[model samples]
Target chain A: MNIIETVSLALRSLRSNNLRTFLSVLGVMVGVGAVISVISVGMSAQAEIARNISDLGTNIVSVLPNFRDSASQSRLLQMMNVGLGREMLEAVPALSSVSAVAQVEATLAVGGDTARATLMGVEPSYSKIIPTDTAFGRWLVIADLSVHSQVIVLSSSIASELFRGIDPVGKQVWVTAGERRRPFVVVGVTEAEEDEPASGAGRQAFIPVTTMVYRLLPARNVSMYLGQTRSASDTDAAVAQLRRFLSLKSVDPDAFEVSSQQALLDAMKKVTIIVTSMLTVIAGISLVVSGLGIMNTLLTAVAERTREIGVRKSLGARNDDIRAQFLVESVVLSSLGGMAGMALGYAGSMAVSKALNWPPAFNWLSVVTAMGFSTLIGLAFGVYPATRASSMDPVTALRCE
Target chain B: MLKLERIVKDYDAGDIHVRALGGIDLHVTRGDYLAIMGPSGSGKSTLMHIMGCLDRPTSGSYLLNGRDVSRMNDAALARIRNREIGFVFQQFNLLPRETLQANVEVPLMYAGLGARQRHRMSADALRRMGILDRAHHRPSEVSGGQRQRAAIARALVNSPSLVLADEPTGNLDSRTGREILDILDSLNSEGVTVIVVTHDSEVGRRARRIINLKDGLIDSVEAAADEHH
Candidate 1:
């Protein structure tokens, strides 16, 4: 018999009993839907995290001090004790590949504004090394350094809060320390990042490292930090130079922790990828369960049609022909269920994307895998029932109730 | 032509060997109308089963058209049953779920005939039985006589050489049974071998030859040349 005829006959049989077929296909629908929903959420979350991390510049490296001091000192004083001082910053620029250096911390004033901001201390090359866009006035110039200019750059949030929507450029602000503190002129105002760290958003300030070390916080020691790199290919060279210089200055490499932003981002993505793949595999187990449901249904079908089997056998249908008929029926049912499930999965993914406000993207590989899985399920589950039906004896089957 | 030589069919009922057929000799030529008569448990049905190749004789050689069919496999027997013999059971064994036309098409379906040819043959067979208009009606919707006629139509649809009727009229009324017997009489006269197994003497006496079996053995063989046919 032709496959078309067999499929039609099988479909007709299934159609004759609508509730049973629907319940059977329902298993596949739920399995495919679960798989789609999980993969979509994982992929979207991964993409979002990767984008957020990459927004930080890839070439930049951060150096945080290992603060270990006696309890008698304040926390800020202890932090200052762990820092690499002005000697390291002065030594870095003389090296051929060293690009720029900057360091930042908080100094709070309760009089004019209660908010505390990062008190950045940097050299003239800080603007050139980092891609900080100036919104108003000018960046710190070389003339400022020659004239010993004690000038500060106010970030947008600090400018708005401290100056009350007025441009704070050219304004003199006193950043008070214990006894000796000086007034610094605000030369420029830089645009603030929207998603700045919670600790760095309220009061804006910047000045020369020489001025900050000599003037404000004179009682506490502050560190000199490096934040720059060479070209992409020279990244390793820059890191090696810094390591060698730090080793020459300090007794142990454990005195500081050095990390690259790009390395951190890559590591996070790798971990997320592994987690997503594991979740996908767990979802795949449902498909296998759906296949088992199809097998059970087909086995029951054989049992119910014993008399029909006998009639067909007595009429001279070959064993292969009987097997083929039942097998064709099973495959057709499973394929139909698969097709329905794929459609449902597509719709489900689209719904999730709408809910999450992410771009809607369909994975065709998922459809292919679903189809292949359904076909295999049909074949694997259909074999036992087909064999049982074909192996029945005409005499005993005819006598069956 | 068909021949059964000293057929013996023994059934093992636990430890006892109950003989269903005992050294029975029978011969049937082309276009013969023969009836085997016996009461219940007289082994008339067993003999019919052996003659139709649906069952095997324990120690007999069955020759169909001079070909030994006694040792044939089940598949070979099925092929022979589909091609060379037609059976009409006491219950008028039409498929209850199929339409009359589809029921008549069953034999041709196993014959590997194309759909169009099978349909045409089934419709023609129904028309011969004068139930062509009831072709689309299921067996449950049709009368007992109509169902039996439809069964007879299906039996003859393959144009087999022999028609084995095992109590064909047992489920029909007397009038309907006479009508069916008339159909069988006409089929026999048209050169088809007909073997009717009946307990009714009136139905048995209509055949050209009657063989009476008792206790799994042939009690007597009588030739009634003055039958209706």
Candidate 2:
């Protein structure tokens, strides 16, 4: 008989004993449903984390002098430690740009108004390496470095504190450090922080690093370096290249601690992948258990239909014909469960994503794979029972009570 | 034509090796009606099973239409059963889950006929059995006679050359039994070969030739015209 007719015959027999069929299909449905939903949720969470990391800035990797003794000291990464300097940073061929800033607490006064604020000596590239939003005038340009122009850019808090609603651009600011005083023109105003507002943060101002080195004695810097890669994906390569350059200079790599947003993201993504695979394996086990359920139900069906098998044999059905009929039945049974499970999983992911406020959880490849896998599970588990039914002797089967 | 030469069937009843058929030779011409009669355990059913190609003899050759069916493989024997032979069981062995019309379509399905062709032939068989009105009723929903008629319809659905009936009317009353016997008689008159295996002398008397079996051997042969002549 044609396969279509065989399948139809299988459907009828399955309908005749639907309770057993439903019980078997339920196991597969739950297994496939759990698998699809778990993968979707896992993928959605990874995407969210990557987006958050990219928001902070993807290309920034910073190197700090490993002053292991200063863990209790200041939280600042830029510290005065030996063996890390601008020479090593500039020698790195892969870095698109390198930034070194000198951070020191200096006194600032404008026409009898005084405020204790952090004075940062920075390069023109610092504005690009770190995500800084300009509130008013432009940030420091390359000319600021060439002439050692004492141009200061005030943080929004510092601008609001000193100028109080007045634009600080083109104004003069006096900064005293290391027992010397210098007058610097205010250039621009910058936002408070990159992401959320930090509470109780101090006011700050920026000046060219060259000027800070010349004018401010005891300014212990150009020791910490901040490098930017050509792209976020190149951060690991850039760090490796920077390490190799430091090694060539006879400097111990342990002298500085290296960190990057990309490294943290990669670690987080690795954890997510491991978690997803573990969940998929567990789900696969459940599918195997469900396949056993299918086998049990088919075996029971074969037992109940022993007489019918004999009748068919007496009617001239070959052993192959009997095997095909049962195998077709099993495949139909599993694929039905698979289709239902896919629907359930999609709806499950949708509910989960809605609660989490994530992107839509439509993972088409996983859904298709689960469906095909369930059908294959049916075929694989159907073999033994079909063989048992096919190998039965017609005379004995006909004579069975 | 059907012929059997030195057929023997041995049964292993827990290592005892009971010989069911011992050196039996028989022949039946085309369109002939024959009966093998014996009590239970007399090996009549065993001989009938071999005759219908439902089983293979331990040692011997069985030729149906000049083909050595006894030595054929399982697939080949199944093909022969589909196209050349049919069986009617004592219990009227119809699939209880299916309707009468569907029960009649079983052999045709094995014959690999298409759906429309199977439907047409099954309808024709049911009509000839005079149970077309009950074609949609399941076997349990019909009377014993109607159930036997449905079984008979199924036996003839493939238009096989030989019909093997094992106690075809054993489960029915005398009236219904006679009706079933009339159906078989009409089939024989239409040039179809008929072989019946029964323990009832009255049923054996209806055949053209009757062989009485005893202890796995043919004990007597009753002539066709000698009983009432």
Candidate 3:
């Protein structure tokens, strides 16, 4: 039989038992849908992480206290006691500039509304070094750090949650830390971050490092230091120099960790790739299982249609014609199911990405990979059944009732 | 139109070899009407299957229209069947889910004819069998006689040179069976070769010639003394 006749014949047979057709199609649909959703969600998360890393700037380096040194020590406690000296950072020729990074948990209250926030204390030049964009008002100035001005910059999440529609800048908010509550005026509001949860938690309030160390803390200390290399190519040299400079200052080499932004970006990319591949393999096995379902259905069809096959054979149909009929049927089954799955996976990924606060990924690679996998599964599973139908003896088959 | 010589068919039921057709020789001319009749296990069905080209005899030299088809491959045998033969079964054998018109178009579909030609040919065959009005109805929706007529329509759709009917009227009432016999009478009168395989003498009596088989070999061959078409 020709291609058109064979396809129509297959379709007619499938239509006669629509429940069977639907069940087989449903198996393939679920398999393809899961793979598509997983790949798209993974791709979107990977993209968001890459963008966030790039936003941190390529030439930047972070010098953090190695919390892995002692598992008994809490991160917050170790972070509070960390103090990177200015002399140690300025000694490195590769490091063109450095800024102090410190943090403390504090409660901010405005009239009846109160919210807990992490107070991030940094140098006034931190904004210049890290490209910090404010949603309103202005960033910290040099005079604010020198004069120990009691000013605060709220993150957009905290600004919206604590002050609602009221302009947060120029408003007075009480900062309570270490059994002391003092009024500090809001100077600016930072732009909302992409990775923040939908619940508007993880709020940060930024202030000058000098104001935090002199006025808020009983001891003078900073948590960490952020350094900027003169060029992207100088990032590795700056990281090495910072580590050496710390060891020369009588600090243990294992006590502090220094890493460049590029290293972190590569590590994050590798981790995402590993995670996506693992998920695809898991979803791929489901596709293989659905393929087996298709094979079982087709085998049953061959058994039930023995007489029809016999009739066709007597009507001068070659063995190839019978084989083509069943093969085309399975391919059609998978193609239809695959198309529906693609649409479902697209919508599912979008919904999930919306919940996770990442942009919905539209990668054609995922679509191509899913479609190829589903169709190949159909072909692979269809062969045995098609061959069985084609090889039957007309006399025996007609006698099958 | 067809010749068979020294035809022997054997079946291997695991251990014992049972011979079905034992060295039978037969000849059928063009425009002939013949009947094959025998008791159960008399090998009449085996002979009919061989005659229909649905099975290869264990040892035989069969010639159809002067072509040695005994040694042909599956594809070649299929082509021969498409161009030279048509079949009618006792159960009507129409695809249950398809309309009568599509059922009738099966032979032409295997022949690789285009839709326009297949539709035209099946329509003509259906009209000839007086089933034109019920062309769109499925086999189950039609009466037994109408279903058999549709089967006859399918058998004639490709205009094959020979027609084989196996117990054509076995499932019909006497009146409906008479209707089918009359149609076969007219078809033979129009110079088409017809071979009917049945045990019913009533059906055998209508043929111009009859062959009787006992066990595996032909027992007798007789020309009907009286005939009407």
Candidate 4:
């Protein structure tokens, strides 16, 4: 018989047993739905990480002293004393700008209110390497470092804490470290970064690196150097150049660590892949379970329809016809479940992304893969039952009640 | 025409072999109306099954319309059943879930007819059976007589050379049984070979020829006078 007739026969049987049909396909629907939703969620997290990395400037690279041991720390301190940041800029031609960073803990006294905060000393190029906008006044300029100006830039939270409801620009604050206190005028108040507030963007104060090293914290050493490439695409080359320069300047090749945003992105991509595969495996288990469900249901259906098989056989339906009828029924069941699962998965991903305020990432490849896999599952699980139905003897089957 | 020579059918019931039909020889010409009558376990059902091609004889030479079908495979027998013979069981055997029209269309569907042609032929068969108005009604929704008529329509829809009925009127009242026999009589008059297996003498009286089966063998064959008088 033709496909249409086979399909009609299958559909007629399914329609007569609607609840059984629905129950039989539910496993496939849930499995596919879970797979799709998990894939979309993974893609969304991947995109979020990528966006954060790009937000940190893809063209920027950071070089930090590897202070694994006290010996290396002392060596790194001695290297910092010799102005390694300037030497790095002079050695790497791919680097457009470089900034040195020194950090210390200090108490700030402003209008008789004391707030302890991390004091970061950096060059004017630091603003360019890690882009930030000022909510109030101007950022430190090259002239400010050349003249050892006593000017400070406060994060929005620090500014509010130090000088509540009033603009802190041009106001004097005392930075007391150890037995010395230095007066500095606030130059700018940096805008708040809501997404990454914990990344030292809300409670720190910035001053010229020269002022910090020569005046406030005379014994402090530079902790890290931030470098920017001439173009975003040249970040890898710039990192290599910086690594070579730092290795030549240091006693050990592993004394300094240099990394770019691309390195971070690669690491994040690895994590995303692992997570995606892990979720896929879990979903695969569900799919297999559902495949078993299909097998079980179809076997029961074959048993239940033995008389019908006999009737059809006596009416001239060949064994192949009966087999095709059952096979088509299962395929229809799984494919229909797959379609419904796809829709459910899409909605699930959208709901999760909305709840988490994440961008919804739809992967068409996952959709296609899920659909193809579900169809394959149907065919794979449909074989035994169809064979059983087709192999039944017409005489014995007709004698069945 | 159908011919059977020394047909034997054996069944293995547990370790004991049961001979359901023993060396039965029969011949039926085209347009012949025949009835088979016997008590239960007299091999009447077995004979009907073998005649309808639903069972294979253990040893026999059977021919239908000049084609030897005795040693044919199940698939080949299915083709013969689809194209050469139609069956109406005592239970009506109408698919309870399908409408009368779909029930009639089953054999034609197995015959590989297209949907449009199958519909037309099924409707025509139902019309001929005088149950066209109930074509869309499922078997469960109709009375026993209507269901049997629908079964007859299914049997005739494929236009087979022979129509076999196993107690076609066993589940019906006398009036409905007579109505079904009348339809069978008219079909036989229209040059279609009809065979009925029944225990009811009233049903046997309607056939032109009757074979009484006893203990897996034919006891006697009777030819009746024309009922027109």
Candidate 5:
């Protein structure tokens, strides 16, 4: 018979035993569904990580004091005294710009309202390194730093809170820490970055580092230095140069830590790969089990249909015809299961994405791979049963009950 | 025309080799109606299987329309079965899940007929068998006589040169058995070669020629009077 007739015949037989067909294909469906859902979640997570890293500025690197262990905490604190200031960082040939920031937790009082906030002391170039744009007024400039101006940039939410629907630019706010009240002029309001954690959005305020050291907190030391490389490709070289320079001046060379967005992304990708592979291996086992299910089901079918096979053989069905019919039945079963599993996986991913507030990503490569694998499983597992059916002796089969 | 010379068939039951058919010779021509009669274990079924090209004899020469098929491979035998032989089993071995029309289309399907043509030919066969009204009914859904008619339609659907029926009415009532025999008689009268294998003397008496097999050899050949036809 033609392929269409053969397939229809197989389908008719399957339909006669609908529940068996469904049960036989369930293993494959669940296996494919698990694989597709896991891959999609991994892809979306990878995309989110990439987006967060890019928001941190691809060419920028942060140098922090490494708090390796509580035993070395005192030594680390002492090593932090070694100056890795803007001039020293900018003098590195690989770096294009540098900014040093020192932060303190303080209460700010503006227009009879008080709110807790992180007060950051930063240079003018800090805006360039971290890449934030002001929603109103202007950013701190070089002259502000040279003059040691007590000028501040408030985030959008803070500006709204302090100004109460009025423009906070050019207004003065009081920053108090332990009864030490200092007045700083709001020069700019920075826009809130999208997709930031709700806790970090409006709690930060930036002021000139010179102003912070001279007026706000004279005892607080620089907390971290942020630098931008001349080119994205030069970030590693810049980080290496800064590390070497800091190590030479510090008593504890291991206390200095430098990291870039690319480094963080690489580390995150490694973890993602491991997680995805582990999930895929688990799904692969299910697929193999499902293949075994197909074999068992087909073998049973062959045994049950021995007399039918005899009748067909007597009616002139060639060995290949019988073999083809069974093979087509198996492949059709698995491919249909794969398609259904894809739909289930997509719906599952969407539900998970909604619950987790993440964007659902549909990975086509995984879909194709899963489908192809299932089809191959059908072919691989269907062979023995189909061959058994085809090779039956007509006389003996006719005698079968 | 068909010819079988010195047909011998053997079966190995463990280490013991049992001979099913020993040195049988037979010839049949177009429009001939013959019956092969024997008790159980007389190798009648083996001879019928060999004649239908379902099994190859241990030593024989079978020629159908001048083509030697004794040494043919499985695929070649299948082709010969498709185009040259039609079989009706006593059990009415129709696919239980298929409608009568589809049951009749089995041989035509293997003959590689197109769907529309196969459908038309199967319908015609069923119509000729006087069961066209029940073409869409499954085998289990039909009566024994109707199911046998469907089986006969299946045998004739391919317009094969030889129609081989093994105890065609073995499971039917006396009336249904007589009806099936009358259909076979009409088919033989219409110039279609027909062979029926049965152990019943009454069934054997309906054919124009009866070959009674004793053990693995033919005991007698008799000409039965065609009184009913």
Candidate 6:
């Protein structure tokens, strides 16, 4: 028989046993639903991480001091433990690719509001290399260093809390050392960064590097330094260049670590992809079971319709016709079940995304993949049953009660 | 024309070799109305099944239209059954889920006709069987005679040259049985070869030729009065 007639007949038979049909289709639906939901969760999480990291500017690299040790040692001893220095900062300019550099200490501060802020000792090129600018005033510069000027730039939070609505630039602020106090002019107030859960370390103050080294923190030392590159992709090469420069200057091969922002992001992506793949594979198990359910159902269907087989055979249906009819019926059922499951999966994933407030990820590839898998299930499951039915002897089938 | 030459069919029922047909030779030309009669286990049904290409003879050649069909494979036999032979089972064998029209349309469906052709042909066949008014009704909704008539319509749907009825009247009351017999008689008169297998001698006496089977062998062949259409 032709496809249309075969399908109609199959549909009629299925409808006659509506409960069985529903039960069979339910297996596929659940399988698809599980797969889609899992994929969506993975996609949404990936997007969220990517957006969060990219928002922090992938070109900006933060240098944290390898300070697992105590901070009370002498300058020479701190230098011995300290990894990076002026050699690294000066070599950044030679890379032609390294846009700017800044060295910072965590000890220097402004009082009554003396807090442990990253006291950056930067050049005027720091503004050119990165995009840092004062919201209310100006930052320290080379001119201040030339005069050994006692000028500093407050972070937006410290300036607001200490200076209290006053533009701190050109205002005198107290910088205290042991048994002595000096007045330093606040030349700038840096802008406060947008708060994010992932980047909570964006607040800091700027000072002339010469002044910071000679005037303040002379007892401790400059340990950590930050670098910026012309492009996000250049960070790796710039880090390599800086590492080579610093190692040559320090004569210590393993003194410091040069980590790039892109490398970190790539690592995160790799880890996430691995997790997502594992999840997808785990969900695939349910799909395979669903396919097996379809096969079992078709097998039972062939057994139940033996006499129907006889009737059709006697009515001029060839063995191939019988085979085609059963095969097509199976495909139709599976494809329809696949479509419904896809719809269910879509809705379920969307609901999960909404309930979790995650970024939505509706993967058409996943849907198509699900459909292909489900169709395969039908084919794999239906083949044996169709072949068995086709192989039935017409005479014996007619004689079957 | 159909011919059975020394047909033999045997089955090994456990330890015993039960013979269903034994050296039974018979012949009938086109448009012949023949009845096969036997008591239970007498092999009359086996003879009908072999005649309809539903079964193969063990050691004999059965010819249809001058071709040996006994040695044909199952698929080839099914093809001949589809195009050249039509069957009416004792149980009517109507697909209960299908409407009368759809039931009659099955053979034409197997003919690979398009939807329009199958529908038209089925309607025409149902009309000839005088059940056109109930074409949309399911077999469960129709009477026994109507169901048998639907079966006859389905059998003729492909316009087969021969109709095989295996105890066609067995499931019906006397009136419905007579109604079905009359339809078969009329179809034979219209140049369709008709073979009816029955255990009732009363039914067998209605055919133009009666072949009696006993102990798997042909016991007798007697000519009877021609059935009037």
What are the lDDT figures for the candidates, one per model?
A: 0.74, 0.84, 0.85, 0.87, 0.86, 0.77
Best by TM-score: 4
lDDT of 6 by residue, A351-382 (tens): 87888777899888889888888888878888
lDDT of 1: 0.74
Using TM-score as the yardstick, the better of models 2 and 6 is 6
| Candidate ranking (DockQ, best to worst) | 5, 6, 4, 3, 2, 1
Q: List the residue pairs that clash in candidate 1.
A: none
Taking the tens digit of each residue's C-alpha lDDT, what string does model 5 give over A1-401? 77777788889988888888998788789878888888888887777777778878789888888877886765555444214575556468898878878888877789798777788888888889888799899988889888888888988777777778899988999998654788888999989766433343338888888777667765546777888898889989888887787777665677778888889888998898889888888888888888899898889899999999999999999999999988988888888778887887788777777787776788899899889988998899999999999999998999999
Ranking by TM-score: 4, 5, 3, 6, 2, 1
Give a tens-digit lDDT track for model 5, residues B76-151.
9999988888899999999999999999998998999899999999999999999999999999999999999999
Off by over 4 Å in 1: A39-277, A358-361, B1-26, B34-78, B85-98, B164-166, B195-226
Q: What lDDT score is found at residue B205 in candidate 5?
A: 89
Ranking of models by lDDT: 4, 5, 3, 2, 6, 1
TM-score of each: 0.74, 0.82, 0.87, 0.92, 0.91, 0.85
| First chain of candidate 6, TM-score | 0.75
Better of 4 and 6 by lDDT: 4
lDDT winner between 2 and 5, please give it: 5
Most DockQ-accurate candidate:
5
The weakest ten consecutive residues by lDDT in model 3 chain A span A72-81
Give the range where candidate 6 chain B is weakest over 10 consecutive residues by summed lDDT: B220-229
Off by over 4 Å in 3: A67-96, A107-117, A133-138, A141-207, A210-221, A229-255
**What value does DockQ give for candidate 6?**
0.74
Superior by DockQ: candidate 4 or candidate 5: 5
How far residue B130's Cα lies from its native spot in candidate 1, in Å, is 3.0
* Predicted complex 1: DockQ: 0.32
